[model samples]
Target: MPAILDDFPVLTPVTDEDLALAVQAVRVHAPEDWPHGTLCRSERVPYPCRLARWGGVTLAAAGLTDDQVSALVGTDA
Candidate 1:
């Protein structure tokens, strides 16, 4: 098994469009999440799954390690 994904869920990476949207999601929501209203995912995690999904994509775009990304913002799965 690839060591980077050893303990993570079996999820596909976020797409380019998803990543762009995720950047928007993070910009519009992070540090504060009211913009997303009740549907916002931050009610639980510090950076909700949706936001994290986008962040993951951004990290991937930047060519970071999966473990590094997970360690930084965690996975969407």
Candidate 2:
């Protein structure tokens, strides 16, 4: 039987387009100096910012590993 994770598409080796979309999503949704430390509050964040954060979370949940996510953000995820 196939594993549940297998049911979801895996973005193996990630791609430039993926990174672009993530960045764009964050830029369009999130506010300047967004995603601050734990001190940050969600309710204060913009709707689009929340959506962008959700999008990244969704991608990670789908199958994107920390490394892959890091590549997208140009950091060590």
Candidate 3:
């Protein structure tokens, strides 16, 4: 069981294009202060919208920590 789990194949391999797009999504979807509460700056949905979450997950899967993601988010600003 352990071997099977360890050897499990990745269904979708991460590519440079994917990473770039994820980074863009993360940066563009950054949260903003709304009169009611936080929301996504790009799509204007709630903060940490689907695209942003997907980017964060992709970055994490690519070995970036939460701090790293936060730093990445701040890099453009």
Candidate 4:
């Protein structure tokens, strides 16, 4: 089971573009060779990042609070 589980409200929902961009951003910016805290797992790089940014935006669009959205996936979104 995945330890990361956060419920995202259907308010804004996730668009195909958003998902795609998110994946790409994570892939490109966060190289596997980077250290654990080297922007891999942190809010230093604009939180969830482009993909994560979409998530936070969607959640916010759903009427969630900033903290709530950030807390949803149990990750810093």
As for candidate 3, its clashing pairs are none
Best by TM-score: 3
Candidate 3 CA-lDDT value: 0.77
Tens digit per residue, CA lDDT, model 2, 16-70? 6665665555444543444553321234454434446654755564577767765
TM-scores of all models?
Answer: 0.32, 0.37, 0.75, 0.36
At residue 47, candidate 3 shows an lDDT of: 83
Task: Please report how far candidate 3 places residue 77 from its true position, in Å.
Answer: 13
- Candidate 2 residue-wise lDDT at 26: 41
lDDT leader? 3
Model 3 agreement with the true structure over 1-77: per-residue lDDT tens digits: 76743422322466777778778989998889999899999999888887888787777777777778778778532
Query: Clashing residue pairs in candidate 2, if any?
Result: none
Error of 1 at 41 (Å): 5.9
- Candidate 2, residue 72: the lDDT equals 63
Give the alpha-carbon lDDT of every model: 0.50, 0.52, 0.77, 0.46
Count of backbone collisions within predicted model 3:
0
Count residue pairs with overlapping backbones in model 1.
0
Q: After superposition, how far is residue 18 of candidate 2 from its true place, in Å?
A: 8.6
Distance (Å) between predicted and true CA of 59, model 2?
A: 1.3
Query: Which is the winner by lDDT between candidate 1 and candidate 4?
Result: 1
What is candidate 4's CA lDDT for residue 18? 53
Q: Which residue pairs clash within candidate 1?
A: none
Cα lDDT tens digits, model 1, 1-77, are 57853333313465666555545554444443455443335434445455555554565765667676444443342
Instruction: Determine the C-alpha RMSD for candidate 4 after optimal superposition of all C-alphas.
Output: 12.1
